[model samples]
Target: MPKSPRKRALSSPHDALFQWTFSQREHAVGLLKAALPSSLAAAVRWSTLRVEKGSFVDRALRSRHSDLVLSARIGEGRVYFYVIVEQQRDVEALMVFRMGLYMMRLWEQIVRDQPGLKKLPPIMPVLIHHSDTGWTAARAFQDVVAVDGPERAALLPHVPCFELRLIDVSGGRAGDLVEQALTALGKVVLWCLSVSGDDARLEREIARTAAALDEVLQAPNGLAALEALLRYLVATHARFSVRKIGRLLEKAAGPRAQEAIVTTLDEIERRGERRGRAQGERRGRAQGRAQTLLELLTARFGAVPAEVSARILAANEAALVAWTTRVLTAPTPEDVLVEDGKRPAPARRPAARKRARRS
Candidate 1:
C-alpha cells in the first residue's frame, strides 16, 4: 500500500498555506530579497536554508529552525534569515499570541550565540496570510509588544517583524507583475502579492504564469521540470482554463512539439480543474457556514462590532471561503481567531450562573 502523507506538527486551517510556502523555498527567498531593500537583501547574492532536524533533544530546543529559513550573501559575510510564514485563513486573532513564542525562540537563539561573534545577522519574522480574518488590525500581537510607546525607546533592542497579508494584493496588481519573469523566488513572492484579486484577474495572472512557465519548459533540457511546475500551478490556480493552457502550449511549442506538451498539460489540467472546482464548492459551503455563525453572534451579542465586521467582510475570497465552517463551528469569537484547535487563550471559563437562591 502507498504510505500516507506526513502529518505536520502544527496543523492549522492554513496548513496548505504553510505547506505551499515551505515547498517553494526558491520563490520564498526571491520574495524576501525583493520585499526588503536593506543591506541583507542587497548584499545577498544567492540563498538556501538547512531544513533537517537532528535526533538530539537539545538541538530541537536550542536550534532556531523555521518552516523556511534563508541564508543570503552579505558582501564578505553571510546572513541567515528565518521566516515563520503562517497561513491565517480562518485564524486571525491567534497570531497576536503565536508571534511571541516564535520571535522569542529566534531571539533567544541569537543571543546565546553572540559571544563568539562580533555581531549577529538580522533575523526577520514574516507572517504571510491568505485569509482576511487575521488582518483585523494593522499590527499582530508581536508587533505591539515590541514597541516602547510612540516616542523613541529601546525596549527589545531588535525590531519586531511585520506581517504580509496576501489578501490585500488585488487583480490589477497581479496583472502588473504577470509579465515579469520573477525567478522561482519571484513566483513565491508573487503568490502573496496575488492574494488581493477576483477570480478573473486571478485567472489572467495564472495564464500569464503559465505562459512564462511555457518559456521555461521550452528552455533546453527543461521539459520535465517545466511540466512538473505546470502541474503544480494548475492545481493551485482556482480558475484554471483549458483553452488558455492549450494556447500556451501551442505558443511555447510549435505544432510538432505541441502534441507531446499539450497531451501532458491536458491530463494535468483535467485532473487539476476537477480538484479546483471541488475546492471552490467547499469554499462556498464554508462561506455559508460563516454567515450562519455571524447571525448567531449577532443574536447573542447584538451584532459583531462594525470594525470587526468590516475586517471580516474585507477578507479575500479564498480565506473567507475557507473559514466559513470554522466561524460557524467555533465556540467563541476567540476560537474563530485560532487556527485549528490550538489557542493562545487560557482555559475556557464557565458562563455566569443566574442567581435566584434563597434571598
Candidate 2:
C-alpha cells in the first residue's frame, strides 16, 4: 500500500509562495480572470494590470492571509482589486467581515496617499481560498449578519455591504484550471496549489505538472517561474523532500528539469548560510561593543555596580557606543550611564549643622 502523506504545517510559507507566484503581472491577470466572475473578468483590461504595494491586512493578520492589490482598467475606469489569498487549514467564519475591513483599509490608504484626488477608485475584492476543505463561510457581509427580512431591509442602506469574488481551490479539478489559465505558468501554479499536500494526487499528476513546468521553462522569464514553482512544491509537500522532488523531476522531465531544481535548492542553501554568517557577525560585534563599554566604565569609575554592569551587558551596540563616548566627560557613574540629551540628577549633600552653642 502507498504510504499516507504527512500533514503539512500551516504557515506563512504557503502565503509567501502564492504572493511570489502571483506577483508577476501576467500571472496575476490570469489568476483574476480565471477566479473572478465572468462579467468582472471580461471587463478587466489585462494589458493595464499593475501590482501595487501594501497589503490590505495589518501586519498581525498577514500570516493568515497574503494580500495582493492589483490596479487595472475595468470598463474605462481604473479600479483596485484586492486579492486576499487565504491558505488557512480551516474556514474562517468572519471572512466576509474581514474582507470588508480590508477593503476599507485599502480605501483609507488611497485617500491618505492621494489627498488631492476628488474621487476614490472602486475596489473589487477577491478571496482565493486554498485549504483541505471547501470554503462554506458566507461570501457577503449581509449573509453573516443577524438581522434578516424586514429588519435587514430597513438597515440595508446604513450598514456596509460587500461581496467577495471567491475562488475555492480545495477539491477543484486541475483540468478546469488549466483550461481557464492564459499562461502555462498560471496553469501550473493553479494546478500545484489545487493538489498540494496530497502525495497521491501529486504523484498522479507528476507527468502533467512536469510538462507544464517544461513549457514554462521555455517561455520568457521561465527561470523565475521555475524557481517559484520548485519552492512552492517543496513548501507544500511534507512527504517529499527537496531531493526526492528533484529526483521525481528528473524521472518525469529529464535531467534539465532536475538540474534546475537542484540549482535552485543549492542557491537557497547558499543564501541561508550567508545570512546566518552575517547575523552571527552582527551579534559578535554587538557583544564586543558591550564589553568595551563595560571596560571603559570600570576604568573611569572603578568597579561598576551590578545594576550598571547588567545594563551595559543588555545594551545593544548603539547604546554601548553612546555610553562609551559619555565616559570621557561624565563626572559620575550616573552621568556616564545617562542616555544622550538627558542630564543626570545632581547629587545632594546634607549641609553641616551649626553648633548649638554658636547659635
Candidate 3:
C-alpha cells in the first residue's frame, strides 16, 4: 500500500537535498542498485519499491536522524529498507545502537498498521554519511558491544544485531559510487553529496557533473530542481555564493546553458534575500519578547540575576512566551523558568522578601 506523505521538517541543507533527490523512484532505484550487493539488489522486484511516508525517527532526535523509509515486495513477503543520512559533522560511536532503536520503532509501526500480521518484515538499513573526514565508527551492532575474545562465544547469542550498508560521501571513492548510478539526476545528487563543504573539490566536481547538471535542467520542473541544487551548493561550498556559481556556470557550461543558469541564479539570490529578511524579523521578535519578559520579571520581583537575564535573552520566542505566562502566577524566577523534566538553577536572590500588599 502506498503511504501518504507525512509532514516532516528537514534539519539541514544536505538533508533537504538527500530527501528531495532520493524520494524520486528513479533516483531511489539507482542508489539501491548501485550500492547494494548484486545478489541482494537483484532478488527484489524493483517495481514494488515505493516510498513510505511514516518516518520512524524519534521526535527529539529528528535533527540527527534525517530518515527515509521505502518498502518493496520480495516474492510473498514485504520488505522495508530504511535510509538515514547522518547529519552530524563527526562520526558517531553509538550510531549502530541508535539504528537498533530505530528498527524497533519501524517494526512496532508495521505491526500496528497491519493488526493481524503474523510475521515481521526485515529492514535493510542504509547509512549515508557525508562528513568530509569519512566514517570511522563501527558498522555492525555486534562490533559495538564490549564482549572480548574470551567471552565472544558465550554471549554472542544474546547480543542485538544488524549491519549498515554505508554510502560514504567522502574520499575519492564517492566518485566511483556516482559512476555506478543509472539516473542523470542521481549522478548529480551523489556528486553534490560528495563535494559538500569542500571548496576546491566542489568546484572541481561541478566541472565533472556539468553534463548531468545540464541534463537535469531539461527535466520537467528541471529549472526548480537545478535552483535547489545551486542553492545547496552555494550554502555548503565555502567559496561559492550564487554569483560565483553563476559566473562558473557561464564559463564551464558555455553559451547554450548560460541564460537558464543566469535565471536560476537570480531566483536563488531573490529567495536568499527574502529568507534573510524573514530570519531577521524572527530574531527581532525573539529579542523583543526577551526584553519584555526581563522587564516584567524585574517589576514583579526585583533585579533578575545576571544568569537569569542571560537565560531569558538566549531563549527562543516560544520559551519567552511560556516564561512570561508563568510570571503572573509563579512565585520566583526559578518557578517561572522551569521546563518539563528540567529544574532551573538555584535562585541567587535574597531568601525572604516582604510583598507589598495591595490596598
Candidate 4:
C-alpha cells in the first residue's frame, strides 16, 4: 500500500486551475496516455491508474508543495508518473535538474515505505510547460551539466541523469492540443492556459475551440471548471473585461451560458479593477475591494467553496474592508475571512463623547 495523498492547497492561480482540471481521473488518464511515449502508453494498464497523495517537491522552491502523482500497472508490477505543471514566464534551464531532484525524493519515499522490496519501480517525470513563452530549456538533466559534449560524455556514465517528457502548451502551441489524446475539457483548459498570455489570440481561440468548450459545459463539473478557467484567463489578461469574457463565453457556448457567466462575472469581476476587468475604477470602493480580496484569497488558498464565496459576497461593507486589509497578511482564508463558520464582526469605531452643556 502507498501513502495517502493529502488535500494540497495549491498556491498559484495556475496551479489551482491545473490541479482542479487534471486531477479528475478522466482528464488525468487522457493526459498521461498522451504524454507518455507511445511504447509505454500502449503497454501501461490504464484501468489501474491511481492518483497518489503527498508531494515530494523541494520545499525550498515552493510555498506550497504540489504536483500530481499517479501509478499504474506496467508489465507485471507498477510504475509512477510524477506530473508537475511549470508555468514560468521565462525559460528555466534548471527545471529538469529540479525535476531530477523531485524524482529522487519520490523514489526515496517509496523505498522507505517498502523496506523489504528488492528493486524499485520506474518513475517517469512528465512536465506540462504552460508559458506565454514556449519552452526553451534543456529537456535532460545532462543538457544542463555545464560541460562540453565530449567531456560530458566521459562523465555521463557516472552522472545519475534523466530526461523528462515535455508537453508545451505555450501561446504558440495551443493548436497542438487538438492532436493530443485529451478529453474536451482537458483540451479547453489547456487551450485557455496556452492563450492566456495573448489576449487577442484568446478571443480568437475561444471561438476556434468553442466546440470542445461546449462539450465541457455538458459535463457535470463543467460549469465549475469554466468558472475557474475564466477567472484565470481574465485575471492574467487584465485587458480582458468581465463583459468581454462573458460575451466570449456566450459566443462560444451560446446564450445559455449567460447566467452562469454573469454570476461568476460578478464574483470574479469585483476585483476586476485589479485584473483589468473594470478599467480606471480603482477607487476605494466596496465591490472593487471585495473582488481584490477574493482574488488574493483564491491565489493563496485554492478555490473558495461556494459557501465561503457567499459569505464573502454577503459580508458587510466593514467586513469586506476588514477582510481585504487582513488578506494581505493572513495566511489562509480562515485567517483573513472565515472564523467559526463565519467571519468575525468588523471592528467598530468608538463613539466620541460630546461636551456637556458647554454653552
Give all candidates' CA lDDT scores: 0.47, 0.74, 0.77, 0.73
Q: Which run of 10 residues does model 1 get worst, by summed lDDT?
A: 1-10
lDDT of 4 by residue, 1-359 (tens): 11111122113556666777777778889888778777888999899988887677766645322488899999999999998876657777788888888888888889898899999999998887776568888988877877775677789888776888888877757322334688887777777767755788877777877778778777777667677777667656788776887888888887766677777677655544454643344333666667777898888888976666777776666778777777767766766876545755655668988879956
Which candidate number maximizes lDDT?
3
TM-score of every prediction relative to native: 0.45, 0.78, 0.74, 0.68
- Candidate 1 per-residue C-alpha lDDT over 1-359 given as tens digits, one digit per residue, 9 for 90 to 100: 11111222122212333334344555455456544545545566655343322111123422222244555556676565544443333444555345556555655666676667666665554544444433454444445553456532555545454553222233224321222334542453345334432345544455445444544445453444444434434434446565564565456445555666666666665766787898899777666755765676676556576554654555556555455556657676545545555754555579999988896
Model 3 residue 259 CA deviation in Å: 1.5
In model 2, the clashing pairs are none
Best by TM-score: 2
Q: Taking the tens digit of each residue's C-alpha lDDT, what string does model 2 give over 1-359? A: 11111121224555656677677787787787776667767877889999888876878877668788989887757889898877667899998998888888988999899898788789888887877768878988888888866787888888777888877777654322325555677777666777767888777777876677787777766666666666667777877887777676667666677666677667755765887899899889989998888788888789987777777788778887788888889887777778656864555669999878954
Model 2 accuracy (lDDT, Cα) = 0.74
Candidate number that wins on TM-score, 1 or 2: 2
Best-to-worst TM-score order:
2, 3, 4, 1
Task: List where candidate 3 sits over 4 angstroms from the true fold.
Answer: 1-11, 58-64, 175-178, 275-348, 352-359
Per-model tally of clashing residue pairs: 5, 0, 0, 2
Global fold similarity of model 2 (TM-score): 0.78
